[model samples]
Target: MKISIFGLGYVGCVSLACLAENGHNVTGVDVVPHKIDLINKGKATIIEKDIDEILLANWEKGNISATSNYKEAVLNTEISIICVGTPSDVNGHLNLNAIYQTAEQIGAALKEKDGFHIAIIRSTVLPGTNEKIGNIIAEHSGKKRNEGFAVVSNPEFLREGSAVKDYYNPPVTVIGTDSDFASQKISEMYEGINAPIKKTNIEIAELIKYVNNSFHALKVSFANEVGNICKKMNIDSHELMDLFCMDTQLNLSPYYLKPGFAFGGSCLPKDLKAFKTMAHDFYLESPVLNSILDSNESQKNQALNLILNKKSKKVGILGLSFKKGTDDLRYSPVVELAESLLGKGFSVSIYDRNVNISKISGTNKAYIDKHIPHLSELISDDLKKVIEDSETIIISHNVPEFKDVNLRFSNKHFIDLVKVKDIVPSANYEGICW
Candidate 1:
């Protein structure tokens, strides 16, 4: 397969070496003449682990070369991977100048084209960016997406300095496209790579990368803050964290990893309170750790505010479980939110795929039912009826067919707690916090 990679920076250079090593004929394209010259002369431009060897080997084998002309790269290659950079602007939004310009150039080259050429995006971008680029290309080339040529988002997860290893041993390869042709083409490019291929919607794939990086950032901040507090108290933070991580049964494990309700179990909520109490008892100002519960409560309050702002006499909720796949209602913030709304003037109806009325004979049911006694009567098993009845839909979880609900309830508006779509609604759509 002949492949053209735009931009010879870290991502582009690593991709060129890896693809070339995988037996694909790759032409590296970049604006800088030095980068192109370096790749063509069998010298790697980027400083990555094992990349120099791979680039030199592939270049010597006549499988890889570099060129400065975008026209030449696009016209010759069967697949074009847009590995351009999307750096942050002054406002921290994704600056896609390079991406837009590259798309236009690719479209110009495809103007006199006749074959199936797929434009794959390997740059980190917000959701809907690839769709926008595809539209731009389509407008210029007079070609339809997934027909004349396809556009897909294949975001790279390579960390710098170890990119060569990360490329071949990635945690996951997320290819965002609905077209089978586009998916197959991208998948074949990584034929020998050992990684799980996650085929999903473009927006979900885009958000996954952001979510992963942002969570990692959060963990770093948390650890540092804990270390800072431990230092203030003349304690070894590393020792504390080391001991904390050893308990995989509850802590440092997948115990709180699921996408469920807002963390209201017996141990979590209570222990968090206990930590704050202990900190205060010890005269330690632990605002960073203490604020976690407060911030969580604020999120729940935001949901409650959205529901209350609807001003509807009767409001219907699609799911009652804290999450989609769980029945544990302990400290499920949604349950508490529902209880709060019921206390107010608004009448609330609830639905859960996993929860039922007869299954409520246990202690959990008794605890929840004690607060809202009309629970059995308000629970509905059917979703169609829920959509038909609710004035405003508030999607709490990523329940199946929620995307399909947008078309069904055209009249009803949505207060999306989860960022479901790429382009958020202006008039009828409101995200909890985009």
Candidate 2:
């Protein structure tokens, strides 16, 4: 396969060398004469592990070359990968001038091209960028999208220090495009790489890098804060973190990664508060740790707003416990939500088979009595009665009895906090965080 890469910076340089090593004739384009000259002279533009050898070997093999002529590069290649930089502006927003300029140049070059071309955006960009690029190319080339050409969002996952290794051993190869031909071509280009090829919506492909990097930043901050507290306490932070990482069941795993309602159970809230208090007592500021509670409260507020936005006076809560298959009501978010709804003058009805208010005792009983004094009036074991009486139903947890309530009660609007099923039944269904 023949390919042209725009922007001979870190990502472009590594991509050019790696793609050529993968048996593709690659041409690198850059505005800077120095970068172009360096690549043409069998020298790498960026210094990193194995890049010099790979670039020199590929350049000597006549598999790779560099040029400043965008028209020549686009016309000679079957696909063009945009590796342009999307740096931050003064306001911290993405400066996309390079990406847009590259798109315009590719579109102009496509004007005289005879066959279909695929433009792959390997740059880190936000959502909706692919559509804008497609439109720009279509307007400039006077050709319809997916007919004369296609734009695919194939974001690179290369880290700078280990760029060459990361390129060859990417976690996943993502191809976001509407064209099957373009997807197949991109997938085939990465045929030698050992990674799962994931096909997804274009926006997801575009936004994933931001999500990944933000989480990475969060992880680093969290670790540093923990390290600060540990160091002050004369404890080995490394040993603590090593032990923490060994717990694959919860820590370093996807246990609580799902987007859903705010956490309100016995252990999470209590432990988090304790940890934050420990940090506070040590005269240490743990912003990331402290922000968790605020974020959780915001999520609770979000659920409340969703329910109130329905404008229905009668709201039925399908599950009252913190989670499904539990009788525990202490620190339950549903309990708090129900209390809020009742306080707001909404006719609230709850049905949780696990929770029997009269039979409830201990902290759980005390919790309900203090929160909702008139629990006997609002709570019921009859799911059918709750569904039949309310205009809007809130499915707080995924209980077996509430699985197909949407299908059964077509007239009632359902606000699913916990996704009741894989597929929703009605047009009136709303997920709290889909």
Tens digit per residue, CA lDDT, model 1, 1-434: 99999989999999999999999999999999999999989998977779889999999999999998888888898899999889999998889999999999888888878898899999888998889989888988898887888888888898997888899999899999868998998888899999999899989887788988988888887888678667767999999999988999987677666542355655678888886676677777777778889878887887888777788767777667666677767677778887888889677777777887778667678767776778887778888787677777777766555655666667777767655534335566667765
TM-score of 2: 0.98
Cα lDDT of model 2 by residue, 1-434, tens digit: 99999999999999999999999999999999999999999999998999999999999999999999999999999999999899999999999999999999999999999899999999999999999999999998998999999999998999989999999999999899999999999999998898999999899999999999999999999999999999989999999999999999999899888888989989889999999999999999999999999999999999999988999999999898899889899899999999999899999988988887768998888888899988889889889999888999999887667777888888899998987756456787888987
Query: Can you list the residue pairs that collide in candidate 2?
Result: none
Model 1 score (lDDT): 0.82
Candidate 1 — worst ten consecutive residues by lDDT sum? 417-426
Off by over 4 Å in 2: none
Alpha carbon deviation, residue 218, candidate 1 (Å):
0.8
TM-score list, all predictions: 0.76, 0.98
Return the clash pairs for model 1, or none: 261-322
Which window of 10 residues has the lowest lDDT sum in candidate 2?
A: 419-428
Residue 291, candidate 2: Cα error in Å is 0.5
